[model samples]
Target chain A: MSVLALSVILAFVTPQAGSTPAPTAQSRQAGDAREMTLTLPHALRKGETAWLLVTVGMIGHNQIQLTTQSGKDLGNISPFGIRSGQAAGTYTIPVPAEALSGRRLVLRLSVPQAGGLHRATTTEEVTSVRLVIQRFGNGN
Target chain B: MSIYFETTRRDFLKTSLATAGTAALSRHLALAQAPAKYRRYSVTSQQGQKALVSYAKAIQAMLNLPADHPQNWFRNAFVHLMDCPHGNWWFYVWHRGYLGYFEQTIRTMSGDPNFAMPYWDWSDLAQIPDSMFNDVLTPVASAYERYTKDLQTFTAFIQPSLKNYWGKLSPAQIQQLNIRGYKTFDDMWNDVSGWTPTPMTGHLSHPGHFNPENTAFAPTPIARYLTLQNPQLSDSVKKNVSKGTVYSGLEPTNFATTYYQHIPIANPIKIGFNSSTTASHNTAPSKGTVFSTLEGLPHNSTHNYIGGGAGEGSPIPNGPWGNMTNNLSPVDPIFFLHHSNMDRLWDVWTRKQQALNLPYLPNSQQLPSYEKEPFLFYVDGNGKQVGPSIAKEYISMSRFGYDYEPGYGEEIIGKRNLVLAAKHPTASVEGLMKGNAATLTLSAAAIKTHLDSDTATSLFALVTVPRPTENSPNREFDVLVGAPADATNITADSPYYAGKVAFFCGMMHMSGMTDEATFIVPLPKRKEAFANLSAAAGNVAVTIRAVPSGGGASVLRAVTVQSL
Candidate 1:
């Protein structure tokens, strides 16, 4: 390989040294009711706000509903606030401490279509997810 | 489309110097343009990636300079540290000057004369470009380990030298620092330390009475909050940087805000893109603190998310954060890239003003004080201080001799002049949510001037909502006009969609026990959204609803549609 090509390859493949891996999403979907549950290493520390970072390849406008196993609703995460966009990529949904039942979070992912809308996600697509927690209040 | 109008931002300041006439506003006038010397590109672009290598080299060179050297990486950050503005109008122009000089420094150091800083369009990408993590570009690189291993280590390494440099400030520079509440070195250090003397006892050494923690310096590598693996902005930050919100920021014609408008207490209209026109950038406005939507929303939220301050990457409630979160934010390599995008947005906004033939700076009466606010601390790329400079000098991008490679909001520059609509009197809301019967009374001209997308005029609805209790299920509500009374769970695609009004009052008033909060929701200018309103014959009644973004009971108070 050329030196430039090798450098580019290494840049993509290499991971940072001494970095800890965050927990990933475990997906469970019935015919149409799609869901993903994430377990945190620890319960969100006191004074912390958090989000469920979901990487999905969405075809059209879509949103995710963040809630707990016990059905305590956090909120629906929508791109563009009141609006919806395809927003296909690694996107975050607020997973506040109140929604987490002892380090466990269940997300109800949906791509609610308007009349005649179809195929929010294609078959051949890759997805990933993680939980991010911050003790900072964001000056709340 | 030509970005430069014949006049400059300085001309807006000194309207007495030239005819402030509508001749500049004529749609047919031909404008002569000069190409900019540098062009900033998006980090996602290949050219931007190439520029990163040069940028990294410049960072490496700056990092190796002596502690007191003006161009030293840490010393360079101090220029921002000593003279940055927040919550006011100087916010945009100040950053433009800071980034412009730094870009020049990078050009000289990187040996790439064409090198302009590549911007991270987080509004689009939502992640710090993956390449930002490589080598000297990331703050955690080995090059920074010595100066920022920990607070004590960092202080010990740089304090004495910093103090010596502080002692040598020229009278004018010292005067500016004094105006910023930094009369002494310790006074300046207090901001860095987040220190507060006990109010009751007036004692400095009161333990537990002190702030939760001093944001003294950068955290240790082990405590490094953010990483390459988790560079994506959290969803909350993305909420502000969305295409809809960014364009809303650019929609305002005025650069600096009018004083008595769209603040917490008043229903005064005229919302501008940047904040209040204040005497000094370092201080709060004499009227009231107002941050332009762009500054308050996307600008701040992005900074916090990257610094792990916004519910990401486990940042502590207070104390040492990644250099991006604090006054020393310039210490982060990503700061330049992040700010370059901000400067570009200002350019985009300026170009749109040129297209609209609108004044892009404070009016002439407000000019002298606005421009005279001294910026004395900046050191040029050549190691000499930028002596006796003022805010007006940094008003235009041409001052730095750079332009932006067209990014997200540049489409506004090509927007043809919106047709003018005849002036109309004030309009008011007639009814509330009564089985889809909520109505707004409007003058006939309101349809073309306010509701129609074809006109330059804008009309905003001042939405009033009762302060939600801590137990309120959702703190955000979506505003819709002419929606069915029963309409629920509608998205942006709905024709009834106006905009969302969030109860970010505690985020606004710091805290509120108040009865209500009012949000200014600019009615969507899309003609299709108001198709029904134009068709109404008798009493022009428009249905309005404030449904929660989340599924819950609506706590919307009152909404008033009026024009100034």
Candidate 2:
């Protein structure tokens, strides 16, 4: 850090090949998220538990970053990991107790794939799969 | 969607000519013409004859109303439950047997082999514009018109008696009574189409308990009395009258528990709520069949309603089918008829509906889109398996199979406590050949499984899967099970149980993939033993099977003890 700062002050810094531009505040604001889709098992019963998985990706590289948006927080997401070529990974999620079975819900997956160096982002809304929970017990 | 073929006149004439060559023309024609009437012994007697006549007239009058009119729909549904000309009074007997007796009378009189009544298929009206209740260019329009007029006439005839019961009522009160409907015969006489069944006596008063003959609440025996006094009939008709009331076979709890109970009742056969005082009677009390019948437990925590062994239904230990007092339906008199047919079929198939021949998860394990205890009505035959050619064969009996009664075909009750089967064959040479020849037929096992630990004491059957070799393709299969023959002596075999309780295993797998076969098992008539035994100490078997499609299927076996 000291050498880079001193070099900048001395005007000795030079741009290197394959160096991408950092995102500006304005670019980050303009490049919003697009194309969101959530996937899950088709059904779950009331009072039953199930795992919910989420994924987010961007259209182009080096222009956008994706993140989770707003909704009722059921459970926390898994630790993030990096994909070498595909730029995709998995995350485990939880289904809430009050969440009804046999119904669909939309979860916003932000702009695009995270870690897209210098990429602009856009968003899209896609319907998620439905979940249905069943009843239980004897002598009903 | 059915395949059709053309036939030649030459073939038909040739067959007729061949037949004529074998016998004289007159003899052949006479042979084809008909034979003498076949008369069976009659069960009706002098004491019940008058009541039977009155009941018939009441039913006919009730039937002569618009299908959508609340009263007409209610009465029709009631009659349907009591006298469905289908698989006898199976559902009625299972849900309410009193209605079964009434249905038997109707069956006896009509001489219909099967209890099939005409149904107003609403799908026909679904395509028409304006209202589903009416159609512009069909016979249905005329039917509806006649129904409306008959309802109005009946209402006018019954209005005065209702007024006399609660004398000099205010305009607002009278309007409320008319709007909501009538309860007593007098109230109905004053306003036939708008009477409600109230708890206490009104103008059509009679000194009889509601639960006569230990059946459902009696309607105060007003119909017979009125018919006897009518001046329209001849002396011979009056002389042939009978007087005792037959049970109406209404299970008050089944419909009341579903969305139907919310519908307002007007001269209902069974009074749902106590309408005598100003207090609201809709709130169920702490104890009694209304709420206590459910074992005071959550639906999910309680035993599977259609699953498990015996002694379940309504009215607690009495079982819903055995008790005649439960309200079956309010919007339809055919409710009794429909149930009766359902029960009769039950008598035929017994445990076929709860077989393990289909795909299911073992020990109450539920599949996606379903929970452990969630149940579905197949609409097909009581869990019997069939092939594509005969897929549409199991139509509602009331609509077709017009002459269905004793000895229509043959009744095959599967061996008691033996596993019934519906096997899925492989799609290879052998499987294809089996599928081509596999028609809908029921068979039985000779040996019965005893109620002992080593015997497994569990229900089992085979499920059919097509193309089991296919890679993760969606497959379909059917469940098969063994049931008691119609002549089974349940009391002799199972001394402690009173009625049947059907139990079904969850989805099972065939080969590598999941199969969707469904089956139900019923408890034989020995409920007392079940009550006396400790549930925690007993070991129960929970079987799951998975059958693949397009021929050969694999099987998975699992069992568990009673967690309770």
Q: What are the per-model DockQ values?
A: 0.02, 0.01
Point to the candidate with the largest lDDT.
1
**lDDT for position B465 in model 2:** 30
State model 2's lDDT. Answer: 0.23
lDDT of 2 by residue, B234-325 (tens): 11111111000000011011111111111222111111111111111111121111211011111101111111101111112221111111
Local distance difference test scores for all models: 0.58, 0.23
Off by over 4 Å in 1: A1-140, B1-32, B195-216, B220-224, B259-266, B284-287, B310-315, B414-564
Could you tell me the TM-score of chain B in model 1? 0.68
